[model samples]
Target: MKKLAFIGLGNMGMPMARNLVQAGYYVYGLNRSKGKEKTFQELGGQAAESLSYIAENADVIMTCLPQPADVEQMLTGEEGLLQMNIKAPLIIDFSTVSPSLHTAIETKATEKGARYLDAPISGGTAGAEAGTLAIMCGGKKEVFEEAKPLFDVLGANITHAGPAGSGTKVKLINQYMVGMHTAAVGEALHLADQSGIDQSLVYSVLSNSFAQSKIFDRHYNDFISEDKDEPGFALELLLKDLGLAGEMAKESNASLKAGDLVRDLFENADTNGYGKKDMSVLYQYVKQQED
Candidate 1:
């Protein structure tokens, strides 16, 4: 079996890496923060001391960072993966980033004799913990086939979207709807509150009607119902994805009229200090807005 190095042990990455370890793979878990490595070690995974250690030893390197800049830095920075003399590792990224960035990384990987798959994931932290993420991969079919077994351990719905940047393209479209639907849920619930209708009744009815969505189910049941607002998927992260989606539309010379308004909603919520909270907290922000 090939040894794997899993980097960025955050909300999504930690559980995904843990699933890999539980599946009997030899995984070296690395994180920028201090204590996560120790936690991963306790879960029967090795803790990587440095990127150099991973570059020298890992046959497959996987990263699940938060931003495109972080992904680029981890690959191209001083003492980063591409800077080291690696043995042509299979690199997989499970972060939501721009397709253009994925294309650029693929180019760099090809130049370095490394294999790359842009395999951005959906299904949030709950799905990550349950090992049921939907992984959309973009790369050579042969490379994707080689990595499919590893992906199987991390996701239930896995697809090879196409080559180079295709996976991110699909993911961006998914996020586009996610952002819009999230905002709509906020508006619907706020309307219910203002009109003296029961929010729970509204959700129950919509959940059975055409107004239903996975986002509505999750946001209401997990966060909004209890008023918790923990970061299952952070508002700022969704804002970032919405921005990426808008950029993608612009690049394709397509118009996303409603996308602008939704982006502004998220941006306003972020600016009002709801960025780090659960994306469902957009409800609170929406409720505060006046006509």
Candidate 2:
């Protein structure tokens, strides 16, 4: 088994690293924030002090950062993995960054005699915790095959999405639908509230109807109905992915009419200070507009 370095112990990363530990990998966990290190330690994982530690120690380094810049730093910064003379042969990035950045990082990894995969994921925190995420990977077929055992520990649906940037390309498509669906769910629920339909009844009927989705089930039952705004996936993160989608669309000369509108809706919610809240809070933003 390749010794693993799991970087970024946030909402998604922590659970993912824990799952790897549970599967009996000698996984070293690292994070920018020191607080999360103890949580990983409790789960039978080793916590590294810094990226340099992982670079010098592990054979496979995986990152689940939040932004493109962070991913860039991991690959290109002064103390980045590429700069280290470590023998880690594989790097997997699960961050939902741009295809161009994925390609750039893959090239850099190649120069350092390492294989890189842009393997953005889905299924949210629940999926991460459950070890059933959907991982779409872009890299060499042989490298993906080598990584399959590790990916199997984290995801239910593991697909090789062609060349270096295809995983992020597929992920942007997923996020595009996710944005529109969340917006649709918000608007539909707001309309139901306005029409004096019992919110419970609306959810109950939709749960059995063709209009139902994972968004409705999660938003209505878990967070919105309970009036909880604790972030599962934050509104700002969705906004960031949508912004990336907009950039991808422009680059491909594709028109994103619905995507643009949904982006603006999330932007409005973020601007109004709901950015840190769960994306289900988009319902509250939609409802407040009519007040």
Candidate 3:
């Protein structure tokens, strides 16, 4: 088993790291927060003293960060992965960053005798906890193959999207659909409420109808129905992904009519104090618009 360093231990990374530890891989968990590191430690994973410690010790480094800038600083900053004394370590980034940034990091990693893969993931916090995420990877075929065992422990639907930056491309596409579907679910539920239709009846009908989706199932059942406001996947985070999607569209000169519209809705929600709430709170945001 290769020594693995799992960084960013946030909503998705913590569970994924725990899954790796449970699978008998010796994982060095690195997080900026001491509380999160303690949580990871309680899961039978060792907590690293610093980024340099993992960079020096681990054969593979996996990061699930919040933004592209953070990923850049972690990989190329003064006290970053590039500065560490390591021999050919593989860096797998699970953060949803831009293709251009992905390419830049890949180049830097290659120059330092390390491999980098843009392997952004989907399926949300539930999927991360269950280890059934859809991981879209972009890198050299050989490196991808070498990383398969680790990916297997973290994801269920892992695919090699193409060369460097392709995974971020596919992930942006995935996020585009996710944004639209989330907005659609909210709108449909709002319409149903306005029509005096029972929420349960609407859900039952939609579950058998062509309008049904995983987003509907998860949002309605796990959140909207139970009134759970916790952050399974925060609205602010979704907004970030939507912003990345918009960036991807602009770079490729692609039209994102619906993407633009739904992004505004999410932006509104984020600005209106629902940012920290679960994405299912979109339904509440929509409902409040009428009140």
Candidate 4:
């Protein structure tokens, strides 16, 4: 059994680290915030004292941070992992960052005698808690094979996307669709409200029709119906992902005709105080828009 250290015990990371502990792994958890480490320790995970402690002791180091900069800091900051004299540890990243940054980090890891994998994940907080996330990995195939068992413990669907950065590329495309579909769901539901059709009726009918999507089900069933906007996935986070997708598209010279419009809608909504709310709050934002 490989000793593992998990950093960033936020919404997705805490549950993920907890799942590893439940599976009988001697997992060490570190968080920038204060209370989460205490919470993780209560769940049978060791609370790592510092990045140095993790670097010196952990056989495998995993990160599930929110942004590319956070990931980079964990590996490249003055007190970062790469600065420490770590053995040849396998590093797996579960953040949804850019392929360019992912590749850059892989190069840095290589210089430090560390193996790297870009293994961004999906399925939201529910999937993270349920241990059913879909993980897309990019790295050497042999390195991927060595990490498969750990991935198995964390996710239900895992795929080796290709070489370094390929996983983030695939994940960015997935986020592109996720943003588009989420915006469409808001628009459709708002249209239903404008037509004076009961929102539940619209959901019930469309859910079984060709118009249905997993995003629709998630937004309506989990958040909108209950009038709850707690952040299963934050609106701001989706906006960030949409921006990253747009950047990737520009780099690839791919034209996404509706991408800019959808991104603008989310941006306006986030600006209007929906940033901390569940992404499904886009429906409320759409409904409140001036006709």
lDDT of 2 by residue, 100-149 (tens): 99888888889888999999999999999999999999999999998999
* Candidate 3 Cα deviation (angstroms), residue 32: 0.9
Stretches of candidate 4 off by over 4 Å are: none
RMSD to native, candidate 4: 1.0
Winner of 1 and 4 under lDDT: 1
lDDT of 2 at 118: 90
Each prediction's whole-model lDDT (CA): 0.94, 0.91, 0.92, 0.92
The deviation in Å at residue 186 for candidate 3 is 0.6
**lDDT string, candidate 3, 1-291, tens digits:** 689999999999999999999999999999888899999999999999888788788999999999888998898877788877865799999999889898988998999999989999999888999999999999999999999999998899999999999999999898888889999999999999999999999999999999999999999999999989898888888899899989888889999998889999999999999999998899999999999
lDDT winner: 1
lDDT per residue for candidate 4 within 1-291, as digits (tens), equals 779999999999999999999999999999988699999999999999888888988999999998878988898777789889886799999998888888888888999989999999999999999999999999999999999999998999999999998998999899989999999999888888888889989989998899899999999999999999989889988898899999999999999889999999999999999999999999999988855
Give candidate 3's error at residue 23 in angstroms: 1.0
Per-prediction TM-score, please? 0.98, 0.98, 0.98, 0.98
Off by over 4 Å in 1: none
> Among all windows of ten consecutive residues in candidate 1, which has the lowest summed lDDT?
75-84
lDDT for 171 in candidate 3 is 91
